[model samples]
Target: MIRLALVSNKLQKIQLKVFDSSTFSILRCWDPHLSSSRSSSQNLHDPTTHFHNEEALNPTELLNAQITSGELNEDKHQKMVVEELEKVHQNLQHYEPAKSTMFTRLFGRRDVMDSPKGIYLYGAVGGGKTMLMDLFYACCKMPRKRRVHFHSFMLDVHTRIHELKKTISRNQTSKPQPFDVIRPIAEDISNQSWLICFDEFQVTDIADAMILKRLFTELFSCGVVVIATSNRHPDDLYKNGLQRSNFVPFIKVLKDHCDVVSLDSGIDYRTRSSVGKDRIYFVKSETEADREMDKIFKMLCSMENDIIRPKTLTIRGRNVTFKKTCGQVIDTTFEELCARPLGASDYLQLSQAFHTIMIRDVPVLSLKLRSETRRFITLIDTLYDNRVRVVISAETPTKELFLSEGHDSGHDDHRMLMDDLNITAGSENASSNIFTGEEEIFAFDRTVSRLTEMQTEDYWKQWDKKR
Candidate 1:
């Protein structure tokens, strides 16, 4: 009997619930009969076990069994990805042995050459693609492993190669080998049947898309298994667009590498966010939220004189930094600066980082639609695009605020985001987050705005004299 189980975190308690056949309705999840961990807290030491079926032998327990019995290599090649990483599994499954030749074995091959094995999984947004990749990762528990978000992993690659190129330019070194730096990591995976998982594997930005061929090709040669989940379909990747043809070979490489399994679960998992009634927390006081902003004010004020590294700022006590911020421009690599660089995981860090962002009165520029203005527009666009839950205290609402007037220009960067990823902004239906009878379009906005205005005023006042 084939069975699928779901493990979800509800009320901060991670529960492993079982589903019935046919409709997959909840059959049994929280059974008092199964008490691995005595306490309600999600314990790290709890027995993590899941039976393959009615058979008593649980896959997870089997893993644990191997761990204790001095068999470190016990089924590390196969793992059950916790539900959180289902999307990753989908991507890893992209390589299956059946539909693939020896060359097409990247995503589709069964791990061993001796057996009949191949599987692929592909899908759209919030459909638990990463979850599956993670499952593949968990199964292959080789000690030498790496799992990175696509952007950060690319940024690191770019950084290393850039340093090496600089050495070549200096003529101090005859030839700098960038491969030496990242190869050891790759070799670790190649040593055995290794696993590599990349989250949010989409390439629209020129900086990343341009280098995909070389970077991945290098890793591919080193025998590292490449598994990635993307918003783009393989053939249509970066299709019919600027400098997009350069990415064609990359698409081919990916196609040749992994068997494309279009899971297309046809069901969006994101809608289940409101599955059970969660909390609608309200501010303790009208100004309580403001005080929280003050905490941030104190930090920034303290650092005003310091020409700190752009990648070393802390937000709400979490180490936060920007990727490309420098000289007359705040060119940021939010991907690199993000807490974990793994998509939705970073959003939580961001929500906790800043309560209020105050942009004191700078001249309301009636500027033209230049690159700088466009980039700034892109910055804000990206911010809201991610549904950053913050109190935005601006002179005007986002649509009108900071917008240069009469700029009839359109930008590809802004429009590049697809509708699937643009999950509509969180609702303001007066729950605790919006205590004002659904009156507040945004619960966190007003308080954030008020505090931000005050802070921005203070910031300008303190520095204006020098300017």
Candidate 2:
């Protein structure tokens, strides 16, 4: 009889809740090994005991138990994924090799062993791929393991390459080829993590697409195993891009190195969950709006209450402070963001720091508020591009957030806000229109369209991905 129990990190015993198997619909999760009774001699403080308790549970059994306990929605496809992940975990456990290091290379050289094949799980948004990956990552006992979002990982890769190039140039050593920097970066990753799990493994950026083949080839050579989850299949990654033909080999390498698995249980759990949740709010009173936003913030933060704290981000030597943040969920005022002279870089930095953002008091973007409106447009575009989740309390609905000032009062058409802007469905011309003499208004139109989409359950699905 496995009953769900929770133990506080402070070593306090918590009451166990048992649900009748017939009526197990409401669910929560904790370590299943926790029992209502413990012997006086049991060493609750032992780290080894905690580690063993985690290992006692299998991914499939744990997930099934979670479902049975009403902690998760039961889905056959998700259970199948648990089985696949279990295999990968077992393979990793059985894999035998000394940790890759310079010390081993010099003093204790050993033959390179074949690394275990990893899985590439692909599916529609909110199908529980991330949930399974989280389970797998938690169950992995390997000391050399790392799980990172693909976007952040690529950013690190690019940053490291830049630093390496600067070093090479400053030292006046041998001229390094453009491809030469990838080896050390991959080697460093291999040395640090034998098992690498990437969330939302996308390759839309041309810079990333160009170097992935060489980079991953080196990674594989150095014996790093990878598990990644994505909405796109390996063959379909970077579907149609500039110089896409050159990026095809990397897809083959990915296919050969990993088992591509798809999980679509024909239901989006997030969408189902979002049935009664409000994503976009139109509020006239700032006080009520702030209170509602705070409630949502607390809900997203969950039981890790202390994790909610302010974060200061340094964007190109400028210090920007977010008033409230819990893990990757952030809360800040629209005035704090748009009133400043921040640009795309600042918003991009914010996107990297937080996956979900709650912006309070978004006023109508009239022509008089041109600078703030421009900044707001830039911020939203960056957030949309990075797939960040945006929750807002605005003075009006999204469609009406931007309006002509005094157009009804017979102001000049050119003086009207909408007259100066010519926006369309999907174009980048909106940012330049007001001052750059560009006719395209699609940037703001697309921004408005994105605002609508972001409010949907589909866009919220991607919010689960790490920032």
Candidate 3:
């Protein structure tokens, strides 16, 4: 029962439970705000003293401390988010509700109580939404709590549905409706976790959209609370999809259950983080380029030792190998990725696994290497659709990446390829043309747009482990 005491000039005397390390990071700053009227000899054995001095500061002062110390750059909106999150932290810290068993309820001895209302924090890219959520999740004292990417959570749900279908197949009962499976799934989830934190919560799949309302209803009934972060507000979720009206109830359910907080900090922190950093570099010397790319990989990986590791991704029974990987970042060569025969499915699998990709030494695409260029187009399309971050070292700039140098012998100018496809070079509809025979040239405009956007901090913020 470790306790944390928060002292402010105007707040009630609130004592909170110290559940996890996040509480320590958030509370250590509160030392400076110690009320001056208090006695100096209070016999308090504070556990957080090892990290910070006896002095405590309020949330704003704590944020200011980070800015002054150069640990974090100051953002006014991010500070406001931190302040709001502090209240949530306090609520969660003091949250202590008795568990209700089925026997207790059935015997007419149940106590009526309400669970803590969760928050939905949504905002533009790089607004520090995920960062604040991480702080909240780290300190939340709930014994049964889970933090998962929304796509991965849905993947698990679909996988469970398949398994449930198998069980029903083996049984002698009549066929169960698809909705019938929701109860068992929701019950399983609620039994395991009373609190769920979802990152990048959006509904793109029709199956997911259909099940959310019923599934969440069961979860809420079982006292499960949800905390989520997303780019869209509750009403804007599942926007413009097939049978979207069927998904409307879930929006209402979400609104009814959670308080929506918009972290409209207007600052692109990710882009700010990337300023002057060479995410994409044009190099004349291959050796110099490789060395620089290696350095970037090490920096992004945050590796103390300069040991590069090999990582393998098994896609469709074929194993693809990467030379360097740490956390959600992967470093590989363009030759290994584009030169080899890989399709959209492989790139889609790669996108789901890695958030940031550092590809080195991308040679300018010409008609001679048409197959590789086409594969590269597909790779970029998949990556862009998934909002994965891309860093590259290339012989040419992004605008010149797909311009044909010549045919196989490097003698024939390849503008004729576009002419043969009857797509003019500067045509207004060129970006939307998909039948140029040369796939790379057909998709070049949009691919270039996505590649350029990927280098921005806003793009980095929209990045998700899954679409």
Task: Pick the TM-score winner.
Answer: 2
lDDT (CA) per prediction:
0.37, 0.65, 0.62
lDDT of 1 by residue, 191-213 (tens): 44345567656554666677777
In order of appearance, the predictions have TM-scores of 0.43, 0.60, 0.55
Error of 2 at 162 (Å): 1.0
* Candidate that beats the other on lDDT, 1 or 2, i.e. the better one: 2
lDDT (Cα, tens digit) per residue for candidate 2, span 1-467: 11222335342221212223211211121121332332222110121222355545667766765666555777889888888888888888878545567765455333568888899999876577766886777677778898876766887888889998888888876765554788778778787887898876876566888999999997887778899988777887866544567889999899888999999876655434432134345465534776657666654454333477788899867788877787777878889899988765678788877767889889887655666877886787568657677778988877778765432222343335434455332334223233332211223554565576566543544433222
Which parts of model 1 are misplaced by more than 4 Å?
1-120, 170-194, 275-467
Ranking by lDDT: 2, 3, 1
Best prediction by lDDT: 2
- lDDT of candidate 1 at residue 343, scale 0 to 100: 32
TM-score of 3: 0.55
| Local error of candidate 1 at residue 361 (angstroms) | 15
